[model samples]
Target: MTTQQLHEQILLKKSFLCVGLDVDLTKIPEHLLETEDPIFEFNKVIIDATHDLAIAYKPNTAFYEAYGIKGWLSLQKTINYINEKYPDIFTIADAKRGDIGNTSSMYAKAFFEDLKFDSVTVAPYMGKDSVEPFLAFENKHTIMLALTSNEGAFDFQTLITNGTELYKQVLETSKTWKNSENLMYVVGATKAEYFTEIRKIVPDSFLLVPGVGAQGGSLSEVCKYGMNNKIGLLINSSRAIIYASKGTDFAEKAREEALKMQQEMEEIMSLKFKV
Candidate 1:
């Protein structure tokens, strides 16, 4: 989806919530283990229940990759279900892929061409060459890892050079690349205070924000600094919603949890941005 399309969804839904599909068989309800594809079953229920509440859904590739071929198939099914059913709800393959140009092209094909995700999270440690290949795809987004929410992010992302943080440099240098307009950055909500400075640099780019729900990052705080005229922040919730219950009624509970966040997000929109 294009930036305008994403913004329009946010405006229409009065929300910028992105539900994370980080499904784990162990954490899911025991009853689902008997299902043929427990992972996909869990995802389908969550998606069906919360589709209207969230503007986007991010399926972290690791959860599926760990289970091998069946896991991959489940991932494909999950993506296909969302694409066919909720085309306007942006789908993100949180793969964090970064490889050589040729490999990046294949990765792009797997996620964008084959699976058809609206965006994919990418690592910037390998520099512009690794990322530019993903950017080559039309209408697909490259969400670069900037200031992450992880504890170890401080080891490099915040490093100072030439009087600016390393992530700031990444953001500025990235603008010089081709098809940079399709670029978005993964700025964690845990680092909400830094977004004002980030928006000064990337006033128009979308930000795929994790660390909001389960990680204890405050939505109101993130929006205080992050929301642009287009509501550029895609705030995500994973465990807190998907694992809200561990019973047969998981989907129903998931919907309740998602709706709680969606309602909170709507209130935030009305009170803060006047949506």
Candidate 2:
């Protein structure tokens, strides 16, 4: 989806929520395991239940990779279901993949062409050559890791270099790459205070924000500094919503959780945009 289409969805839905389909088999409902493909079964129900409450769905690739071939198949089916059933909603392959130039190109193909995800997360450690390949795909966004929500983020992302934080440098240097307009970024909600500074560098760019809910990132705080004129944020909530229950009512419970976030987001937008 193009950036404008995504923003339109945000307005139509009155939400900037991105439900993270980071399914963990161990954490899912026990009854789902009896199904042929537990992962996909779980995902389908969640998608159906909360698709309207969210503007995007992000399936972290690690969850599928853990189960091997069957998991990969489940991943494929999930993306296909989303594309065919809800083409308007954005899909993200939360595969933080980055490698050498050639390898990155293939990785991009796997997610952008074969799987048909609208966007894929990528690491920027390898620099422009590794990321520009993914950005080459038209209308497909390359969400580069900027400031993350993890405890270890300070190890490298915040390290001062040339009198600036490494992540700021990454954001500055990334703009110089070809097709850089297609680039989005991953800014963890835990670092809400950093959004003010981040916006200074990439004020118009979209940010895929994780670390809310289960990770304890304050939604209101993130929005206070992170939101732009277009409401440029995709706040992701994973375990908290998907694992709301491990019973037959899992999907229903998931919707309840997502609705809570969506309602919160709607209120934020109304107060911020005066809609």
Candidate 3:
């Protein structure tokens, strides 16, 4: 999806919530394990339950990759289902994939062409050459990991070089790449203090923010500094929503949790944009 398509969806839904589909067999309802593909079964209900309450759905690749081929198949089924059923809702493959240029191109093909995800999270540790391969695709996005929500983020991302934090340099340097306009970023909501400065560099680019509910990132602080004129924020909530009640009623409760976040986001956008 193009950036304008994303912005329009957020406006139409009155939401910027991106429900994270980090499906784990251990965490899903016991009832779903009886299905042919437990992971896909779990994801289908989650998508059907929360699609209207959210503008995006992000499937973190690790959860599926851990299960091997079965998991990989499940992940493909989940993305395919969304593409056919909810094309307006943006989808992100939270693969965090980055490697040498040639390998990066393959990873790009796996997610963008074969699986057909709207965006895929790419780690920038390998630098611009590693990432540019993913950016070469048309209308697809390379959501680079910037300031993350993890405790270890300070180890490298915050380190200053040439009088700028490593991540700040990433935001500045990446914009110069070919087709860089297709780039978006992953800014952890837990690092809300940095949003004000981060916005200074890429003010209009959509930020795929993870670390809201289960991670305790304040939604209000994220919107206070994270939102732009187009409401460029996709605050992701994974465990808190998907695992709300691991029972037969799990899907309904997922909607309830997503609705709460979406309602909060709607109110914040109203305050920020004064609709």
**Which prediction has more favorable lDDT, 1 or 2?**
2
- Weakest ten-residue segment in model 2 by summed lDDT: 266-275
> Model 3, stretches more than 4 Å misplaced?
none
Candidate 1: tens digits of C-alpha lDDT, residues 111-146 = 999999999999998888899999998889999999
Whole-model lDDT, model 3: 0.93
Candidate 1 segments whose C-alpha is farther than 4 A from its true place: none
Alpha carbon lDDT of each predicted model: 0.91, 0.96, 0.93
**Which residue pairs clash in candidate 2?**
none
Name the best candidate (by TM-score): 2
- Give each model a TM-score: 0.98, 0.99, 0.99
lDDT of 2 by residue, 165-273 (tens): 9999999999999999999999999999999999999999999999998888999999999999999999999999999999999999999999999999999999988
Candidate 3: tens digits of C-alpha lDDT, residues 68-157: 999999999999999999999899999999999999999999999999999999998888889999999999999999999999999999
lDDT at position 43, candidate 3: 92
RMSD of every prediction: 1.0, 0.6, 0.8
List of clashing residue pairs for candidate 3: none
